[model samples]
Target: MAFDGTCVACLVHELKEQLLNGRIAKIAQPETDELLLTIKSTSGQKRLCISASASLPLIYLTDSNKPSPMTAPNFCMLLRKHISNGRIVDIYQPKLERIIHFTIEHLDELGDLCKKDLIVEIMGKHSNIIFCNENGMIIDSIKHVSAQMSSVREVLPGRDYFVPDTMEKSDPLSVSESDFIELLIKRNMTLAKSLYTSFTGVSPVAAEEICTLSGIDSYLSPKELSGDTFKHLYNQFTIYFSAVKEGRFSPAIYYDGKEPKEFSALPLTHFGGYTRKEFSSISEVLETYYASKNTITRIRQKSADLRHIVQTALDRNKKKYDLQLKQLKDTENRDKYKVYGELLHTYGYNLEPGAKKLEALNYYTNEMITIPLDHTKTPQENAQRYFDKYNKQKRTFEALSKLIQETQDDITYLESISNALDIALTEDDLAEIKEELINAGYMRRKFTKKKIKIKNKPLHYISSDGFHMYVGKNNLQNDELTFHFAVGNDWWFHAKGTPGSHVVVKTEGQELPDRTFEEAGRLAAYYSKARGSEKVEIDYIEKKHVKKPNGGKPGFVVYYTNYSLMIDSDISQIQELS
Candidate 1:
């Protein structure tokens, strides 16, 4: 979900309650587009994080602190010089806009009392944090926006700081029922579209919720609605905003299985089927949602180079493997050449002089066959020529068979590396994968005087039946968990004929329950390359039955006997230990 106007309002309410009279204790710029401000309020010291990132703009109160650079940025220095130790006079949001205003009071250079506004606009792409004087003149901004960037508003220093009037949206807090219906009826758009477009803070999801509450179709245009339906919609809209007006917010994140799907300032009836995890404050909701999203996004960004390397190698190996198979297919007729040579040796003496061909009965099949003859060559030479052709093809077949197997193995190893990348969640996981690639000669090993050690562990989970389960994140971890970690009596599970994590369940010499097996199977399926499939076929056996070849690649094993089960890739019910 977007950091919509309703979310902004909830944040403003929470901030006012926490930091209305707080003193600016410290200021730091940990990133180019972010700021961390420590404020000493009546409650306690709290850190407020505000980011104007073009991709993910956010403002939330967090307990965690980020390390700053040795030197402060220009914007941070300017802010510290002007508003250092300033008292937060008031904190408020303007109408339903996605903006927050922090009015600070402090003594100026002349020892006279003064006020300033630190405004944070949460607009996507155009988001900015501007410091303004009492007269609303921009002093400086975290990001400088020129006239060329946005003609509607320029956020450079000394420019007039005002909210852009391009939206021309009405404040939902004061919008009357008659005005709501009349304004919406003029627009030739869907009911949901008109609500968000007509009001300052109503988002598309919130508009849908209103329509659901009023028993109206959000897709229907306001112009097509009957008078009775419009009245009902207006009634529901007022009731919905009443929570915002009264500062009654229910912050929650809805989850689709284990993944966060959407977050809302108020309970969304439309998402009733989803698992809603409520929070005591809006900041908690924003922090949790964005933190989870950022972790996944950051890991992907960091793993891009590794992914590119793995994919390139995989593609090259796959093409080579295909060509090798085609070449191996051509060697199938080598046996036919051998038969021709044997037939020639038996019947060459019977050929006439200057004969172009020889017809002989193939004793093996009792069938007549014609053999082409080099007329200039003697019968002995012709027979030797056929024998030479057969010997060359026989040698070619032998070489190609070995080459094809090696190429096929290379393709498999590269694919497993690719799958490992897909499941990588941290830099440590990536480091382990990179080590594997370097060891396999796919990547060049870096020469360093001091060796850097990476400690990466497999995922641990507790099944419903109190059984301990472990899932490998990458090939290296898979090998460690399957061999060194598990005893002979422990159970092992893996996705059948696919690149995936090896799942191990420690039995401790007790009988296994069906529930534990199913849970472990889900983990094996979820961490594997076949994740998100409706059902995955899994092969399971005792650790004693799973044997790694003496020179096999990491995670490669042979199991002659195992049980197979079809299980889904859902691990939401499984409890994982961090």
Candidate 2:
């Protein structure tokens, strides 16, 4: 499914059909690697996307538009000067190599009708977009290739332009059976490996497709086939080769269950249809899946110290609260202890002057504390000291009890905030969570200037069945997605025990389906740190049950009555926005 030679061929065919006789209406560069050209034809208007990026070079008809920069790049301005209102003359592919050329006829500043060429080369690591004049003299390139970039070609202004030779490459559409067998044996590799590695135009997916058509194991060694077996294999190969010549192609995204494996052999998709190019590459799949993994890693690192602090505070608070409660309960017997000590001191005088024998008394305070008596001391002096000791102990208990309660409340507050952060889905949600820390005196508040406004949109995915699923990337977006966009009956999903994006499946009043549930699980898992794990637990429920708590951190919510399932976080299963 990667942007293979076949995709380049498709681009040539499309441009020939739509842009060859059309007039260029507008041009813009949406990204560094890409260009968008709006053309007007007798049929209607068409926008063509062209890219010469090493990683994702592509050319296709696209309906989606992007915001253009205020000032056009010099290259863009130059293209507009020479090619604006130009009529495309022809679309040509240089043999079967990864290059396409669009020749345009237009008037120059002197009003002479002249020819110009736009060449897009999509060879990985050597990809470039070159503009040349009528005589094939290089004008400039999107990327200037010098001796340092590539010795094979130098793309600079005023340089002569020519296509490089690729003699070792075999065109699968034109190869004879004898030539194929000889090449296969010469490569000394497996059939699939030879087909994939020896050819300049074929993708691994295409190699696999050829093997599938041949009814042979792609992994089988080239030397393993017998003469008769080779004959049968050649016959099958010829059939597929004829199909290629006839332009019989089917485009389907291959998947291992819920994950996208590749995209090729297609019933062609047009603009506004599912954009296979978005998930056509294995690298794209890896990037999306691992981005969520890195997010989880960052969250764990950020919260590690905070988690420990909360745990220690909680333990100390619990211990102090328990001790304080016990001390306060002892207050019931405080007066009793004081009365007993006083009675002993007062009654000592009656027993004998300066006598030490303690006598029992009816203590008004409930439980009693025994008092030590001295034979030499007067009763009044002992009684006075006893009262003072009782008052001091009582006051200390009251103060400790109030302080302990305050500590318990602080622990409770911190614990709640920690729980909210543990479920934060995006960096914006983390920002709101950190604000809580600042207000609670755990973080310092610097007089930071407010940030400039930028619109944040939800990450959107279109399901295989054509349902639109929206994932909120931050708490604000989550709130908007769930409370604003989601209907009561729409399904909501999130990763269990992990902070993740809110995934909403817009049911549009349709009954819930199993595939939809699985797709939602993939979204939930892919948006969480658990995305890289082989499997993750996902919780799902109706949108109605998901409630944003009052005064809670962004992306924080409480929901009950949900079901859970285990799923692999592989986004290779879901279709991403192009």
Count of clashes, each model: 0, 10
TM-score of each: 0.85, 0.57
Task: Report the error of model 1 at residue 414, Å.
Answer: 2.0
Tens digit of per-residue lDDT, candidate 2, span 343-412: 8665655666666546565556444444565667667766766677788778977797778767665655
Compare the candidates by TM-score and give the number of the best one: 1
Which residue pairs clash within candidate 2? 1-263, 250-265, 250-266, 250-267, 251-265, 251-266, 251-267, 258-573, 259-573, 260-572
Cα lDDT of candidate 1 equals: 0.90
Please give me the total number of clashing residue pairs in predicted model 1. 0
The pairs that clash in candidate 1 are none
lDDT of each: 0.90, 0.72
Among these predictions, the greatest lDDT belongs to 1
Candidate 2: residue 433 Cα off by (Å): 13
| Model 1 alpha-carbon drift over 4 Å, by segment | 21-37, 51-56, 66-91, 101-121, 124-168, 176-178, 212-219, 225-232, 254-262, 267-277, 352-354, 445-453
Model 1 TM? 0.85
